[model samples]
Target: MFPSKSDFLLRLTTCLLSWVSALILVLIVWFLFVESELVWREVGVLRFLTDDRWSPSGDFSSAQFGLFPMIVASLLLAVGSILLAAPIGVGAALFAAYYAPRGVRQIFPRIVELLGGIPSVVYGLWGLVVLVPLISAYHPPGTSLLAGIVVVAIMILPTVALLTLSTFQQLPTSLIHSAAALGIAPTGIVRSVILPASRSGIMTAVLLAVTRAVGETMAVLMVCGNVIQAPSSPFSPVRTLTANIALEMAYAMQSHRSALFATGLALMLVVTLLVLIAEQQRGKAGHV
Candidate 1:
């Protein structure tokens, strides 16, 4: 009877907690909509989206608020960093899961897990102190879209590596053994058997990593130079939507404050889309 009561309580607790989480998500969406409504009403969604600059001089009447540059920067930063990190992260995962020696297999993944544990601010600080200077040596000012991409790639690398490693580890050992028994080289076995088996899993890792890279703020803000312009080159100074909101939200008033909320709303939608994509990949992986 006591065990039955305890089980009921546990089940009830989990159900309540699940509802609470759902409530929080609904609340967040409600809050963003409520706060952003003013901007949508005032700016008209199309004009707000298509305007080409973000400059605030004396007041709201004289100021121009454009999100295009920030939007472009954020996309470039997210895509470029994912492109740079995906291959390296996948390679590391393959090495750790399949090719590493007995001793290295234990140590390598622990190092990667530890890297993921480090705080974003610490990465930002390191970039500010170390990486920015290194880039500056090549050019007059070091902070640019390139710096943000490098920092974000490094930040998301562990995420990609860890997930891919888990995916690789889950592959059926019997299949690998059969391929090897057929006189296939290690490289050929990986390319033909393991990679095809793990395609959906690898994509899930990449989409999840891109989600993180898109939402990253502190490190990007510190190193991205915060210039509101479309990035013409990797070296061009740029500002992301996250960086823009972080830089201005504090002192902003009225329309400006609502604009920040609108930016947050945009970010939320983008993240939600990425999350949906990742979940679809995860479902495919499960079926595979």
Candidate 2:
């Protein structure tokens, strides 16, 4: 009877915690909507999105409020980071899971954990001091779209690698042994068996890494030059949406504050789209 009551209490606690988390998320979405209503009405969604300028603090009569440049910049940073990090992260996971010596396999996870544990600010500081100078030596200014991509990629690499490694480790050991007994080489086994088996998990890991890339602020802000412009080249200085919000939110007021909230709303939309895409992919993989 006591065990039954304890089990019921545990279930109740978990249920309540889940509800609280969902409620918090809903409240945040509501707050963003309420705060962003002014900008949505005042500027109109079309112009706010299409306008090239982003001078919300300009004269009240002619203050320009646009998101194009920042949006492009943010997209460039996120996409670039994903492209660069995905292969490296996945490769690291594969190596750690299959190719590494036993001693190295044990240590590899610890290294990945340490990378994940490092603070974003430390990564930012490292980018500002070390990476910037390295890039600056080749390009006149070190902080550019490329710099942001590299920093964000570094920040998200551990997330991808760690998640992928966990997924790889969870696979049925007997399946791998069977492939090996069939006289398949390790590489062939990985290609034909491991890769196919882990596709869903790999996709999920990439999705999470992409989200981290999209939302990263401090490291990208420090290295990306923070200029409000479309990212035209690897060397082009640009500002991401997250960086813009962080840069302006503190001093924003009235419509400006609402505009920042609108930016938050945009980010939420991006994340929602990502979730939808991931779900679609997950469903397709399940069917396969």
Candidate 3:
């Protein structure tokens, strides 16, 4: 049978959009590579990645561009945000999917979606004004790793919750009904049936949230104190790879600029890996 006009138009439009997106991504990676090649030649990949100093300017003797601290800070911030956001987001998703009244089910999701729509800069400002002051009451400097983590967690919470809720909503009603008929308690049905069935989707949601946390710049830059030191504790100030690039890219020149491009390349690589992993999990979820 021939495809209808609407169907053909829809397929053509989607295919064109997909190719455009792929082309744009390729251009970005190519730009990063061309710009960063100079630094790669001078610094060597191992030292550029593993060294703990990031002084891009000094006498040729003492200048160092170690990224270990920023790398560590980025990992800590992303992981910490995931740790804090996952359980809360998942629980809220479960409540929305399985327990909420119809009105609440409608309103709550919109509220969460609105949270996601809020600008990153606004979140940064809020963190700096409200969260930083609150933390400063207990800790000396308000801006620290803890503040960054909290801000990121809040920023990603809506993403996780909405995605997880969609995952739960996708479960077959018949399967849930069968479990109910078999005398499983509601909680038991959730634990043994719903959770296991939606595991891949939940993992995808969590990974996507982690990706957002890893790539977040403005909020983290504002709250993380921009200190290029490995964090000793959650209260310690530290700079992340994204924050480092954003902070330095404006004034950087020559090798300094190239190094910042290298930092962006690193960030791109990390986010790309995460997106690929999430896509894999999403594919598995679709199959299940």
Candidate number of the best lDDT: 3
Write down the RMSD of all candidates, one decimal each: 2.3, 2.8, 3.3
Residue 28, candidate 3: C-alpha displacement in angstroms:
0.3
Q: Write the per-residue lDDT of candidate 1 for residues 1-288, one digit (tens) a residue.
A: 547888999999999999998899899989998998887776767766666567643455566777888888999999999999999999999999889899999999899999998999999999889998999899748898999999999999999999999988888898899999999999999899888888888999999999999999999999989989898888888999999999998898877888889889989999999999998987885332
Residue pairs clashing in model 1 are none
Global lDDT scores for all candidate models: 0.89, 0.87, 0.90
- The lDDT-based order of candidates, best leading, equals 3, 1, 2
Most TM-score-accurate candidate: 1
Q: What TM-score goes with each of the models?
A: 0.93, 0.90, 0.92
Off by over 4 Å in 2: 1-18, 58-61, 276-288
TM-score of 3: 0.92
Clashing pairs in 2: none
Model 3 misplaced regions, further than 4 Å: 1-20, 50-52, 58-62, 286-288
What's model 1's TM-score? 0.93
